[model samples]
Target: MRELFTDLDIFNAIGIVGVSLYIANYTALQTGFVRGQGYVYPTVCLIAASCVLASLMQDFNLSSAVIQVTWITISIIGITRMYVLGVTSRFSDQERLFIRHMANGLPEHRARALLDNGMWLTADPGTVLTHEGEPVDHLSFVASGKAKVIVADKTIATSGAGMAIGEITYLSGEPATATVEVAEKMHLIRFEADKLRAFVQRNPDIGAVLEQNMANHLRSKLVSMSETASRAPVPASADAAAA
Candidate 1:
């Protein structure tokens, strides 16, 4: 048994270990134990690929070496991409809050990915976000300031920061029921409806989160409207009859 164990045996053992690591990583990902896009997954893959390459050095096999090299390259690329995304998507406290209603509970990278689909812009007071009776082509989130919801030249509701604009129309596949006009100088993140729909289709998890957020937002709006209605004074004509 001692004679059977040589330097070649040790190298072969390492190669076997490397193969085991690679398979384990893949199985973990396939079984949903690990996220494929996460840092740890790719890092493990990189280490496994390196070990396999080292083991191949003892007894050169061109095909095995080539596979190991390719694996290493792919793992390195994945690591780099993960790192870059992490660095670029770090958000400030206020910024995170601004997007929280829509992206709450999402993985950091996934939240960042959802935010990347929109363009940030500053709008002056009176800027029309959506025209009444027009097709809804985009959705916007108010990061700061306020907007007025107008229908047929009458203001109906006021939307403040953290509120969603054009969401109702965007979801309903109908023309804008009201015109959304900036009531104060505002910063907003706007996403093209078609592009956003495509992205949602591609990433169902993010899409699910977004739908939940929208539902919550709508519920809050309904509650607010109900409270406002409850507090409103009755018209004098109606009061006169009661008196």
Candidate 2:
């Protein structure tokens, strides 16, 4: 068998690694594995550029050096912009609370996109948020006040702050699972289904964060329901039979 390499210098190895990174990064972007909006892409490009620039010390190429330097400069600019947007982003109190609770890991810019697409509203008491078996037009996050989750006109649960409404139908494109009625006037963050779906399709990272948030909230609700069921008193007839 013939050997592919006998002796590879450190600088050449670094340059090869850089080439690999360049190829891999581009491939990841094309394959939907990495997003162009975030820091990871630019950071990887910066590192790759650095490696290629270092390799130029071993065997200089003016054109290659220029390309690498340009890549490095562009990458640096992109990274700096993303950082600034995340750091200098402004948010209101309800926005801050919503981001902290449901979309904690989102970059401020993306969080802003989400919040901007949604509207903040106050629902008066007796407002019908969702109707049973009807298509839900939007998703709601309760910033304040309370609501009842009703099925067949029976109250099954109370939704308060930090709870997500219509997330299931938002994901499934199904009808509302239950009727939600505002018992007390509610401050709400509402995202229309069409807009949210479009945004999520365009920015999947935000979708991922939202999905995770929904999963966590649903799990907690399940746990609370389980506890409530467990605490229910035994029936009198059952208790008498046990005695």
Candidate 3:
């Protein structure tokens, strides 16, 4: 071990660090901790490439130098494209909200692509967003409104801004679990079910984020239902039946 350290110059140490970073980044990417299109992905790769190139100055290797340079160039291009095209400063108010809230863990460009597939509009009070026992042909994301979750004509819970409607049956191609009625006028981005499903199928990463968002929304709705149920008075019919 002491003999090995004898040849380990500063440049070799830098090279080792760079190799470690490469392995770490690849591991993280495979584990889904960081997305390939996200800033961290290319940024880390760029740093690793730079470190490797710096080490090559101490001990020259033509092939290794060429590879490192190419890696650095690709990383720079990726980073530049992400910044130049995914300029959040130019995004509209709703797009910003979607990015901040609904598009969790997705790259901004991919989020925008998903957003482009939908139609943004305002829905009025008493509007039926989804019908219970009917196919959910569309999914609505509530941007700024509240809706009642109705099951068998009883309002069981409320879904507010940042929640998705008709998500329960989205992936399964089943009937909606409950009807959703707009209790307050709301801004919504509506996506056609067929198109959304196809888009998701084609983009698995986006699909994964969508599923996560839906899961979070569903859990919140469940909590709301639990609270509402806890507050409800015992029905007179139940007492009468017991008597």
Candidate 4:
């Protein structure tokens, strides 16, 4: 095997290793960055070893050298981005806020009232929390984990701990325009619409808190989407429509 490898061009060998490393780096990034499986590091290391082996060989070419360098450059950037993503995921404000909110929703005294009124906790990543274009039957709170609100095939926001999911539609008694999907394994607390309404009637303060929170969240999300769209480049078709 060693003798057969010796017959290959030195630069080509290095290039192959570099390409492998770059691929591994990007894959690791997609799978939750550094918190991902431990196998990516070992794969990267093996690729680096291959590059060293190639440098020791005799046959080398300009094409091989260029390919090898390109791979190395790409790998370095990919790995750096992976590390940055890991760091950001760990300290994201949105993530932290979700935790805080989940821990501190409507007072504990109100929880039983919700549960007695047909509210129950369910945890499932595969469950369809809400379907777009369908009438919402319940109001859901994120007791734990995260969910994405998808409107017209576009992701509107990721709701984390302490956030409610279906209040808008539940309150308006209208068909839902957005679908809520579990972005991560989530612990959802749900209340039947009729029961929720009864509880609100009895505990007006808690009801007000829930409504205000939902309205504020919607406003914040809209403002954020608008700002992001403003900063993004407009396609020719979109610009023509505006003109």
The best candidate in terms of lDDT = 2
State, as a TM-score between 0 and 1, how close model 1 is to the true structure.
Answer: 0.66
On TM-score, who's better, 1 or 4?
A: 1
Which candidate's TM-score is highest? 2
TM-score between model 2 and native = 0.88
Which window of ten consecutive residues has the lowest lDDT sum in model 2?
1-10
Candidate 2, position 68, lDDT: 98
Q: Which stretches of candidate 4 lie over 4 Å from their true place?
A: 1-122, 231-243
- Per-residue lDDT of model 3, residues 1-243, tens digit only: 999999899999999999999999999999978878789999999999999999999879999999999999999999999897677536678777766666777777888888999999999999999899998888878889899989999888888877788787886778999999999999989999889989988887898898887778778777878988998888999889999
Model 1 over residues 23-121: C-alpha lDDT tens digits? 999998878577666676888888898888888778898998888889889989988887777777888664696568778767677888888899989
The residue pairs in collision within model 2 are: none
Candidate 4 CA-lDDT value? 0.64
Q: Per-residue CA lDDT of candidate 2, range 118-217, in tens?
A: 9999999899999999999999899999999898888878888878888878878889989999999899999999988899888888988888887787
Model 1, runs deviating above 4 Å: 1-84, 92-94
Tell me the lDDT of model 1 at 158.
Answer: 88
Candidate 3 ranges beyond 4 A from true positions: 86-89, 124-127, 183-185, 240-243
Clashes per model (N, Cα, C within 3 A): 0, 0, 0, 2
Q: Give TM-scores for every candidate, taking all chains together and pairing residue i with residue i.
A: 0.66, 0.88, 0.84, 0.47
